[model samples]
Target: EAGVVQSPRYKIIEKKQPVAFWCNPISGHNTLYWYRQNLGQGPELLIRYENEEAVDDSQLPKDRFSAERLKGVDSTLKIQPAELGDSAVYLCASSFGRGRSNNEQFFGPGTRLTVL
Candidate 1:
């Protein structure tokens, strides 16, 4: 089985600029999640998708952040007009079940965004 994949492991952008990240979940996994980890902080769920439907997205900042999982196999997160405070690690995780517990999630290394 393949592990999760992400591109541009690091990014640097000016405030108010736009940035985007990509992720490809593990094969056969039915649940995918996007999380944000501020420096020295644990990951906070940004959005979660079960198959094709977005099960959770309340934590996402609609003002400048957006995400999508078109085929339920891969996802992308975009930040338009990025803010300096948006600098953080964007992680993509996947699981076999949709439960909110340990072991279910296998996290990617994360895309580290540095807003200047």
Candidate 2:
């Protein structure tokens, strides 16, 4: 089955540089999510969107991270002045809706970023 698709499976950049990751969700899915996973930790939610509106982004670092979902299909996550601590796997996920019973999300392969 076709699932969420993400580009640039890996990225390497300087600490102060900027980086971006893209994601394309499954057809007809209306909710999307961005997550960050460190070396030994589980994926942490960075942002969540219901269509084009960001319904949950409290965990996102507003000073350095920004995300957008255009036309509610494809989404992009960007990080400016990427810090060494920002080196992690960026994951993208999508689901049919945000209801409690319909929250099962399909995840992408993820973009692994390495900041030096």
- Candidates in order, TM-scores: namely 0.94, 0.95
Model 2: per-residue lDDT, tens digit, 1-116? 78899999999999999999999998898999999999999999999989998999999999999999978889999999899999999999999977452678899999999999
lDDT of model 2 at position 61: 99
Cα shift from native, residue 71, model 2 (Å): 1.1
Clashing pairs in 2: none
In order, the Cα lDDT scores of the candidates are 0.91, 0.93
lDDT of 1 by residue, 30-93 (tens): 8999999999999999999998788889999999998989898899999999999999999999
Candidate 2 wrong stretches, greater than 4 Å: 100-102
RMSD of every candidate to native, in Å, equals 1.3, 1.2
